[model samples]
Target: MTDATLAFAHGDPHQLRGMEGVGIAHDGPAPKRIVTGYGFWIFLLSDIVMFSCFFAAYAVLLGQTAGGPSGAQLFDLRSVALETGCLLLSSFTCGLATIAAGVRNERWFQAAMAVTCVLGLVFLTLEGREFASLVARGAGPTRSAFLSAFFALVGCHGMHVSAGILWLLTMMAQVLAKGFRADIQRRLLCFALFWHALDIIWVGVFSVVYLLGSAV
Candidate 1:
């Protein structure tokens, strides 16, 4: 048999080449956990890109208030600060849940996840109230370009939080029913990533949209 044929018969054909000549080495498919986490990261990055566009729009329209109420006139810093606190605390609880999941401690995992969900809900409630108050004050999205962009950016984030809460509940149910099978664990990892990403995005929103806007 030829030397190359012998090498191919013994192991991966790609390994026959020198290090510099070889392409990416395939050591079989990546584990489900890694694959799942990587795919979710891609999804999260895409979501962030979408949010970035909204942020850019908000910035451009920030001064185009059409002689309507400005952000400084409408934004309540105290309320926004409270909302930020809830979301940030939820992120901490999410980390606890991920740690518990690593140890397969079902009780602790569920409790941490529950706290995370509650905090997320609290954030949504505060945001909903803020939106309602603004609308009542004739600051609805249709009133001006500034208001429209603001609603599009902040409201989209609120919707994401709502979706995350639903996802959190689903994860809890799956754990209760399946007891953290490998697939479930992989899913939990993805959830943790998603939740943390949302928290990061919220930090940006609070800094740029709320703090800066109120100051303006």
Candidate 2:
């Protein structure tokens, strides 16, 4: 027999050609959900890397205040504590929203998401007030390298939270209009991943920036 015939006789012709394993033992494309989630995770990882760079920059410039206020001088533990509580609680409500979505419970899902949105708003409001207070006290980003690093790190996180809130609202509207459609569900899953990621990043910020910065 010819080489092709011999190879086919030894095993499956497609396997011999390596075509069967090309799909990773599957016959077609991966499920949409898996593909979407994997892509979203890549995006999340890139975001994390960016935040890590910001953190490193902040650390390097932590004490670069040119005769200006430092974090320990300007940091308010009470407001930071309240912000932390709101964000952490929002993470919990976000979990409940995910659970409700899984069960296709529209009412509960909406309610949970609404609560999450409210908590996120509260967190942002507190952050905004804190920023305003800092700026009023001549500690704005332009005041010193230390303040610049602090604002860049914390402000970036706040922008992400704001974006997440907008995305959360969009998800709510999509679900209400589409009734848990597959695409809607996929978007919701991505949103959950993004939101949870923000929560984790915030924890890091709280520990590194707020806690450590305040102590120093």
Candidate 3:
């Protein structure tokens, strides 16, 4: 029944006003994707705020080298560029995966997720090499406050990426086992948002930590 009709039928607009809604059925649970996405968005915002604090700390400590090597001496821009490219490509593949999930295309979804997983692994591998080379050259996090902050800021991001890779693999396995269930699709939505958030954070990291660090 219409809102007005329902109100008249109930003989009380006050009761209708206090209710969730008069026209729509309020008995069933909310769509899982909407609820899940809202919760995940809150989580992603909290994560971003945490990262912002780390960024702020790094900014404050950027000049505190303690007689150790600096970004110019330590960062290989080419390697960082490669890492950035891999993550960007992974984001693209993740987008494809989301699209495929929405359309219930199992093959394309798995393919896209696989590519994203590979790209993420490549980014992590390059990052690991970068860290190793820095340690080998006596530029470890323990060497200086600047190095410490750098590792804290970037390492946290790396850990998030690692988690995302694991999540992606789990989703792939779930899709293979359970097919395109609604719960699984909702999970894919959350994963896509998380992966995209990493891309955004990386842009800031490259700008503030890598590009500006090397120049200034």
Sum up the clashes in candidate 2: 0
Listed in order, each prediction's TM-score against the native is 0.87, 0.87, 0.87
Clashes of each: 0, 0, 0
Q: What residue pairs clash in candidate 1, if any at all?
A: none
Model 2: what TM-score?
A: 0.87
Write candidate 2's Cα lDDT for 70-113 as tens digits: 78999998889999999999999999999999999999999999
lDDT of 3 by residue, 9-81 (tens): 9789686766655454667788878999999999999999999999999899998999888888788899999
lDDT of each: 0.90, 0.92, 0.92
Q: Lowest lDDT 10-mer window, candidate 2?
A: 18-27
Error of 1 at 126 (Å): 0.3
